[model samples]
Target: MQKQAKYIFLITFLIAGLVSQAQVKQDTLKREVEVTKAYTPTISDANKLNSMPEIDEEEADKPTFNYNIKSQPVFSTFSVTPLKAATIETTPPIQKGYGLVRAGLGTYYKPYGEIFFNNLNSKNTVFGIHAMHLSSFGDVKLKGGDKVDAPFMNNEVELFLKHTIQQSILSVDLTLNHDAFNYYGYPEDPVPAPLLEDEQSINYFGTKQAFTKGGVHIDLDDPGAEMDEEEFGFQLDYYYFGTKTEQRENFANLTFNMRRPLTSGVGLLDAGVEFAQVSNITLPADTAIGKTSSTILFAKPAWYIGDEKANVTLGLNAWFILQTDEETQAKLAPRINANWAPVEEILKIYAGIDGAFQHNHYSKIAYENPFVKPDHHLKNSMQQFRLYGGFDGKMSKRTTYKISGEYAINTDKPLYFMNENYYFDAAYNPAPLIVDNTFDVMYDDMNRLKLNAEILYASSKKMDLSLSVNYYSYKMDKQEEAWNLPTWDATLALGYKVTEQLSVSADIYLIGDRKALIIEESGSLIPEDLPIRKSFTLDPAFDLNLKGNYQLTNKFSVFAQLNNFGFQQYERWFGYPVQSFNALAGISYAF
Candidate 1:
């Protein structure tokens, strides 16, 4: 019963404590409310803001700036010397023509005409054609009344074609030539007319004239901007010559050349082959004529060394020759050349040692001297060695100069000379008359030395001038002199622009004295005896030529040329005298 009561009391006490804690919590959580009134204020100045400001708003006060100016005296002086005037400046006229036609007539019944047409403006292909004709129908002063007319006529036609495609350039050329001349330099005969006529009939040397030549050439090359340089070329030519004495010659030549770089560096190789056949139909087939056919083959391998400032080329040129009735010959020659630029592009020194074989042909001989006798045998000339050195440099701002020297050794060098025998009517008048006009080929060993100098000056405008001089010395074995070769030669050329439409030019040529063999009659009773040969000196030659051109219109121009103004009747060959002073006036039309 006591435990029960204690529990009840404990329970009652816990309930009472809980009840008191709740009542205290309620008392402590009693809510209290505090309220405050909200105030709303109206714009009292609304009417005042709606009106404008009291200050004036239409304008503001004006602003101004002040300036101050000052002055000072200056002094200057002028020089007494005046400034030089500048040269007259003008641009050259543009030519709007693709074809040009030129025709002219001059003294000695000379007539000249030329026609040139070109379509070179095409990007891929170019074509051109040129034709020229020159003729002289003049009368020469001969000793006898043989109605000798020194007539000469030359006609030429050339066609050119070039094509470019993808790093390669190809070109082709065709040429045709016809040349005619008359033998009018025969001397008068002293014998009676009948006897002289009979002698002439026996050895009738008719007017030898006429040469016709046709040729074609083809070239294919790479200029080598991206690769090595390569080139291939070929040429074919046919020549026919006829003389009034029934002398005729036929010649044909075929030549091929190739060049290739062996490596991407400075190594190169070149090769060439030439085949030629010449026939002198006038000679009997059974006679011992030398070399109806000839063939030459050559090869060169080279190495290029050095840089832009200095360079050298070392090469070996090997060649072989094959001719009918002769043993085959082979040779090797050194080709060493060098160039040094001491002052960049302003001065250059060059030296070389070169050698080659120069083959002679009947066609070339007849071309060089039209009066060569057909009975003579032709031979080859070989240049065994040559040493040359030169230097070229700029002298001033507008002037340049060059000096060169050379020494060469040649074997079997050919020279032209008159035959020692003369035909005459010995039964009648014994005096020799009507000398032979035919030349013979003489071969000898020759040594040549030469020195050359040149200077050129070009002004800023209006004028240009150039002068060149060459001196030569020769020593020959088994020959009296080097026939027909000049020892000294000089040339002077001047160009002046007087006005825009008019221009003038002058050219002068000076040639030194030359030696020739003169035949004099020795007291001999036999008609076949050889004549006495004496050395004769020919006078020096001086030639001056003047030319002027006036452009009357864009398509038409007039030109005048005065040739040999000094009126010197010089003999270019042994017996051929060139004409004196001559003039030609012509008009050119372009389209």
Candidate 2:
């Protein structure tokens, strides 16, 4: 009963509180709520980890590497063992000498001498002096069996000095020459009363002709120079010529050469200028014939193509002349050339068209033909043109050959003819001696053709042989024949070395003669109409010569020469025959 009474009271109180809360919820009111702290949830780990295991690459597997070694250049002193050691040999140097002297005498009363003095093995300067003398005291028989003293004396002296300035060279040369000859030529057969035994001797009436010449040359060669520039070189030449008579001449010349390179030395531009002046033409005899001087200006400009194996040049050569004796003239010619070598050092072929001019100075005429008289101012010859082709080279190790042909046309070609003159000097006691014994020069136009062949054989065994032959054809314009010019010529030379100090040589010459003229005065001493010039053939000339040399010591040697073995009295010029079977012996010494 007491619990029931407590519950009933509690129930009554709860019911009353619930009724009040319901009334508060049904009423509208404003309320605010605030929180000051943040809440974080926490997790606690167990003993086991959550990650899975991975393979241990360092413990179970290893990496593989591949590499290679390369070779390189290394310098070191390393030697191999030789099987047998011997001495190393070297080649010996050649010996050089300073001075040389040679003297000889021939059976025809001929004496020859030569001497040379020079410096040896000089580094800066080279100097030399050379002197030569050749003289003959002999007589030559005329075509009519008449004898006359045909003596000749030749003397020459040369001095040269060469100095090196850097890569270029400077050279100075001086030359002196003197020659004397006697006029001994006579007409063929028909006897002249003036030269007969009854009359005075002709030798006493005649005088020896003496000619003297002096010359000097100066040159400076410098290959390194600029292109398009004028003065690349300095060259000078001068000469003075005098004769026994009143005739004299002076000549001087200057030359300049220029070059320009294109295409590295394969192609080049070349040019040259030459001014040659011949003056002082004097001599009372030739004065009235117009003693005029010759002045010439020559120029050549060419283009060079190709290289050492094959080459060609194309250009022109021109000339301007001022001749006081004739009209002034200008000339031109093609200077075209071609060369090819099909096999190097084996065969070479060449072809060219060229031209040239030669002065007919007394100095040259006397050298070629000593019988010339100095009473004229002759004209210079002009080579209009020339066409030539040839092939030359070694055929085998011991043999070489050359074959060539040439065709040329020239104007004012000098022809030698027999002098035909009549002079009577009663005041000098003259009975009209045979004065037509000399030679005179004449000018003419002519055409010439030539074919030549040559063979040379040589070996290291010290044996050599040379054979050559030439044939010529000529057609004269104003003259009947090519006077005294040969139509064919041949030569054979052989040499052998029997031992180290002994050697022998042999030579043979064959020459075909041309036309010659013989003039004779038949009737009057001085006639109005002169005899006509006629042409007659001379006999062929031949000569055979042998020579020997023995080297006795280091600086001494002996030589002997035998000429004209057949004693053949061959006639090389009109009314002049060579010595028969001459012999010469000499000794040479080098100091």
Best by TM-score: 1
**Segments in model 1 whose C-alpha atoms lie over 4 Å from true places:** 1-91, 141-148, 186-206, 224-265, 281-291, 420-427, 431-434, 518-531
Q: Candidate 1 on 470-510: residue-level lDDT in tens? A: 88899999887988777887777666768877767676777
- What digit string (tens of lDDT, one per residue) describes model 2 on residues 522-559? 44666785665556787787777777777777666677
| lDDT of every model, 2 decimals | 0.59, 0.60
Residue 66 alpha-carbon offset, candidate 2, angstroms? 80
TM-score of each model, in listed order: 0.76, 0.75
> Which pairs clash inside model 1?
none
lDDT of 2 at 541: 73
Which lDDT value does model 2 have at 14?
37
* Worst lDDT 10-window in candidate 2: 67-76
